[model samples]
Target: MKKENVVIITPCFNENTTVIAFLKQIEEVAGKLPFLFEVIVVDDCSSDQTLSMLQKFSFVSENITLTILPLRFNVGHQSAIYQGLLYAQHLDADKFIIMDSDGEDDPEAIAELVKFNDYDIVNVARGRRKESISFQISYYVYRFIFKIITGKILNFGNFCMIKKKVLETSCHTSFIHFAAHLSKQKVKSTSITFNRLKRIDGKSKMNLTSLVHHAFKSFVEYAEELLMVFLRIFILVILLFFGIIGVVLYKKLFTDEAILGWASTMTVNLFTAALVCVGFFVMGILLLNMISRRNQNKTEIFVKLAEKSELLNQN
Candidate 1:
C-alpha cells in the first residue's frame, strides 16, 4: 500500500522573523505522520527578507517537500491562499490543508485533521483565542452581527483539511473568504476545537482597520442572503407607515379628537420620512447586488511563482 500525499498551503507576508521556525516545526511534525507531506508557502510580495529566507530554507526529512510561491503583488491574505490552492490543484496530492504561517495555527493540529479520513473537510475551530481583550471583544461582536445577517455562525478560520474532491469544486468558485465560502458548500464536514496559540515572534501584522475589513469580506460571501434580510426589513417599515396613515385618517374622519392643522402636517412629515427610509434601503439592495455580481465575475487573480526547490534526504 502506498502512502497518500498531503499538501500544506500557508500564506505569509513579511514574516521573516517567524517563517523559518514555522517551517522547522512543520518538518518535525510531518516526519512523524504516515503521509508524504509537501509544504507550499505563498509569499504575498513581502518587502522584507521573507522570500530570501524561504529560498534558503531546507528540510531534514526525505518524505517532505517544500515549494515557495512569491506573488508579483500583494493581493491580500484570502487571494494569496486562493493562488496557493490553484497551484496545488496541479500537484499530485490526495489531501490539502490551509493555515496561517503564524504559530497561532499549531502545526501539530495537522495530525488531528488527517486522522479523520471519513470527512470531506475537517476544520479546527477556535476554542480560546489568545489575543488581547479588545480584539476578542471586537471578534465576538463581528460574529454576532454575521450570524444575525447570514444565519450562520462562523467559528473557524483557515486551519482545515480538505479532500481532493472538495478542492476541485472549490477552486472554481470565488474565495473572498475561505472558511465562509467552504461553509456554504454542501459537503461532509466536521470540526474539532483547538485553543489558538500566540505568535512565535513579534506582534501581529493586522491592525483594527484591517481586522474590520477582513470581517466584512465574510459578509460579502453571503451578499445575497444579506440583501434578502434588508428587503424584508424594508417591507416591514412600509407596512408600518401605511398602518400609521390608517390611524391618522380614522382620528380625523371618525372622531372629534383631530386638532386643527396637526393631523395633515404630521401625516406629511411621516410620509416624507418613510420615503427617505425606503430610498436608503433600495440603494443598499442595489449596492449589495452589484458587489455580488462583481464577486461572481472575479474568478481568478494574478500571481507568479518566484522560485521552486526540493530537498530530500537520501539516507
Candidate 2:
C-alpha cells in the first residue's frame, strides 16, 4: 500500500454497538479526502464485542488498522486516547484526528480541522451538545474549575486534528490537567462548530460520575503547570499582611487606639487561617506529584512491554 500520510485514531471501549456504523461512516468520509488515509481504532479492552468488531474490519480494509490495546483492566477514556495517539505516532502519520467511537462527534468535520494545519493542533468546538441538564451543569462547573486552575480559557472539544509531533509530545507530558495542552504549543488554531448528535447505537460510556472523575484527574495531572498560582498566592499573602499592618499602624497613629479587641484579634486569626490553608494545598500538590511519578514509572514499564512485544512479532 502507498505510504499513508493522514490517519484518524478513534478510541473505543465497549463500543461494539456503534463500531460497525462508525467505521462505515469514517470510510465514506475518508473516501472524499484527496490523500491516502487510514482509520485506526484503538480498542480499550472492551468486555463486549468491540474486539470482534474491530477484527472483522481489520480483515476487510487494507488501509484500516485496528490496534487492540487491551489493558489488563478497564483503563479510562483518556488513557485509551493516549494509547491510540501512541499508535498513530508509531505508524508515522503526518497528521491525526481523534474522535469518539459514538457518532456524536461528527466524522465529517475532519475537512474543517485540516484547514488549520498551520497550527500544531485544532480542537473542534461542539457548537452544541446533546446532554442531560445535570451533565450540562456539571460540565460548566468543571470548565470553571479548569479555568481557575489553568488561568487560560480553553476552547473546543476533544474532537480535532493534531500534527503527529503534538500527539507524541502530549502523550509524554506529565501535566495531563487540561485538554488544551494539546494546543498549548506554538500553533495557530481555528474552531469549527458541529451540531453534536445524539448517540445512535451504544449508550454514552461517560456518565456524570465518570466525567467528574476525569475532570479531577486531569486537574491533578496538570497540577505542576499551576505553579504560578502558588506563586501568586504567596505574593498576595505578603501584600495582604503588609496592608493589614499598615492599616493597624495608621489607626494607632491617628486615633486613641482603644476598644478594638475581639474583632481585630479575629481578623488576624482569619488571615493566619487562610495562609495555613494555602500552605496545605501546596503541600497536597507536592504529595500528588509523588503519586504521579509512580504512575509515570508504571506507564514506562508498560511502554517497554509494548515495545518488546512489537519487536518479537516483527521478528
Q: Which structure among the candidates has the greatest lDDT? A: 1
Q: Compute the lDDT of residue 307 as modeled in candidate 2.
A: 53
Give the TM-scores of the predictions, in the order they appear: 0.88, 0.79
List residue ranges in candidate 2 displaced over 4 A. Answer: 1-4, 58-67, 174-178, 221-225, 242-255, 259-262, 284-288, 291-315
CA RMSD for every model?
A: 4.3, 4.5
Worst 10 residues of 2 by lDDT: 297-306
Which numbered prediction scores highest in TM-score against the true structure?
Answer: 1
As for model 2, its CA RMSD to the true structure in angstroms is: 4.5
Candidate 1, which segments miss by more than 4 Å at Cα?
Answer: 259-315
TM-score of 2: 0.79
Cα lDDT tens digits, model 2, 228-274, are 56657766766766776677777788878763565477557657866
